[model samples]
Target: MSVGLTQPIWMEMALALLILPGVWCTSWLVLYQDVCAVRGSSVVILCTYHYPETLVNKNLTVEKVMWSHGRKQFFDGPFIIDSNNRTHTATKFEYVGNKVHNCTLQIHQVEQSDSGEYAFRFETNNGGKWTGSNGAKVNISELIISMTTPKVHGPIKEGDCVNLTCMNNCSSAVMWFRNGKPLQEESSTLYLCDISFQDSGNYSCSPKHHNRPLSEVIRVSVEYSPRNTSVSVWPSSEVLEGSDVTLTCSSNANPTLNYTWFKIDGDSCLEMVSQAELQFNVTHTGNSGKYFCVVSNKHGRQNSTILSLKVKDHAEGMAAVTLTILLAVLAVVPMIVIVPMVTWHLVAHRKKTTAPKPDTEENTQTTEVHVTSPTSDCSLTEERREEEPSQQDEVPYATVHITKQRANIQQQNEEATAIYSSIWEQQAKEDLYSVVSRPTPRGKQAQDDPVIYSTVFRQ
Candidate 1:
């Protein structure tokens, strides 16, 4: 019975052997596959092994390794592992780790044409038959790169530091080419040169990797000239009669340049105006509006900022000024003539109202009673009982006054009349063109004399 049981185990082991062929065929197909590499780069090959002898296969050996170029052998070497577990004199195969059986093949500094299929074989035991397998077939490809665009150097002036930079897509080293020629050997982030007429050209660059091609070219044009040339008048927007006006043209160029004036119509080219001091003495309103100027030399050309002119009315402004002066004179004249005459008449009237009357017997008594203000009721009765004085008993008095000053008064009156008459004489003197009824000489005229009279009075 025990033999019967053991016999079934043997049959099952034979069935397992039949499935091993399919598994080994799949593993063999995957071992020798393709390899890929880039130019100016490194490459690595991965290889692993399997054994069916039921041992671990720890002490393995790889011999007669070769790399071929179309049946021509270029590389051949052996991989030897020392007893001390240290490496010595191994060509291309490197032992990575002990857990898995793998031989890694490495190639340094690969090129574009290093692509092809390689073939080799390996044997481990003394009586073991060699197993043949195809090595990797590699396909080489290029790396993509981009170039930076060029920029315009500013403020576009001469004798200034102008710098340029050419950058690559990758971080590798970059080289610059200008006008189809290589630049200097030193590696700098920026290329610098002082700007001048000779600095304009085409520029480009290329990267240091063998996978990339030359970059696209860029053209640079420089405009180095003056700017902000402007023209202005002294008093803007208005030009007065007989006024000295100025037109100034200012720019930023060098070497003491000259300016030329020009005038433009609606659709025509510029026509030259006066080359002198940029200013013109205009007499009428037609000489107003837009004007232009041009500045040029062997280097470049620039046009002046447009300047506009305007004129004002002269005759109307003068007439307004004259009318204002006449109004001021008329307002001030009346106050001069009336103030003194009103003052004299007020003084005479004040003197007449304050004078005292003459004295007499009855009038004196009555005056005495009224003059003493009544202190009590009895005194007030006495003041009323005092008979109102008869006109005869009242002051029948006369006042006679004489003075040489009166003669002075009469003479002043005569002088004032003479002054009024002389006013006519002054008018005649001034208006020599006045019409007259009778002809008269240019000298003095006839006049009258003074008189005295006496009078008597009774009451």
Candidate 2:
């Protein structure tokens, strides 16, 4: 029974050797499913392979090792590298492995065309062949540049700073370009300091020392506040009354601006409107004053120069002209009505003074003559002559001697009455022409004396 057990154990050990070789061959060659690499960089593909231990014992050595692109049968696709023959090896690829089952591959200066599925094949001296059907795939990508902010779109203000970075699968020297010109920077990160309006342009980045694809273009815009603010007025600064006025504000700025119009009050500014231009109709002198405008944006604000306005009062000017004309008419009308009346009174007084007087007797009886009233007419009557004169020689004569005193007294009374009447008529004319009449003083009128005249004559 012991001998029979020993035979069965020997048969089982032989069977285990054959089965282990088959299992190892089937589950050998191990590597990652995919690999990512950047253009103009280097990459190392990690791999762990296996082979049957029975092959090593039988002295079956690896004769050839090859790597190829695409998924096809062994030795069917274009070969990328051959370890056995140095002449057939690719310059970019190298196999750094020992006699063990480690078959790692390294690629230098990777390019876009090198991206594809890659497989490994190995052949032994004992007519043994194996190929890793599940191989690592290479996916090549270009250098990517991005902003380290919340939003990628850039419109930064002047004097501000921004951060930029270059991204890739592997570490490499990166170059920056602005407006299609090299910036001479060799790092993964770039910082733009004290940006200005002139710095606005297209930007791109790529890896150095290789024909690497460039990143997408990034547009950068620079903004600034308003400058050189000014104001303009339509028509003119000094305008007539009842005219339309317009004021416009302008400035230089990057972003759009908001405008506000203000009028200068006594000691402060009063807001009038919120727009680029202010327009209103002027009606009177109240519309004339000082004004200004302000322009603002996200960056800063600016104030325009102050302006003044003038308006003429049309109604006041017309009223002044009318008053002058009325005064002139009043002065002329009084002269036209009073001059003719005064001239007529003077002519009548002259006629009364020059009229002929009746011839008086040279001698008359010496008798006292008296006139009681000033209005009674005085006449000389001829006395009856003693002897009747012939009809042919009709003459009436008086042989009586007249005293000079009586005749002189009678003539003086009549002259005095005429002068008094002329004086009273002149006083009445003066009262009619007086502009403002005033009552006489009570004491002054009582102090003056009254004069009376009487006329007496004998015939």
- Per-prediction TM-score, please? 0.25, 0.35
For candidate 2, write residues 184-290 as lDDT tens digits: 77788888888888878888787675443367777777789988898899988867688899999999887889999999999998999999999999988898999
Model 1 worst lDDT window (10 residues): 363-372
How accurate locally, in lDDT, is each candidate? 0.46, 0.65
TM-score of model 2 (CA atoms): 0.35
Candidate 1 vs. true structure, TM-score: 0.25
lDDT of 1 by residue, 1-459 (tens): 000001123443345446555533442222444566554555665645443443132333433233334324322323232223343654433434232345345655556666675433333342222232344566665443232223433233354455555443233465656687776532424344555545556765555433332556665444455567888777765775555567777775543456787655567646655453466666776666677777765457788888777765587547656788888888778766677778878887888776765542221111111111112323224433354223113322222232234325446435532210111221112211111111121342433322212121221
**Best model number under lDDT:** 2
Runs in model 1 deviating more than 4 A are: 1-33, 53-100, 126-132, 143-459
Tell me the spans in candidate 2 whose CA falls farther than 4 Å from its real position: 1-22, 25-27, 73-75, 146-157, 161-459
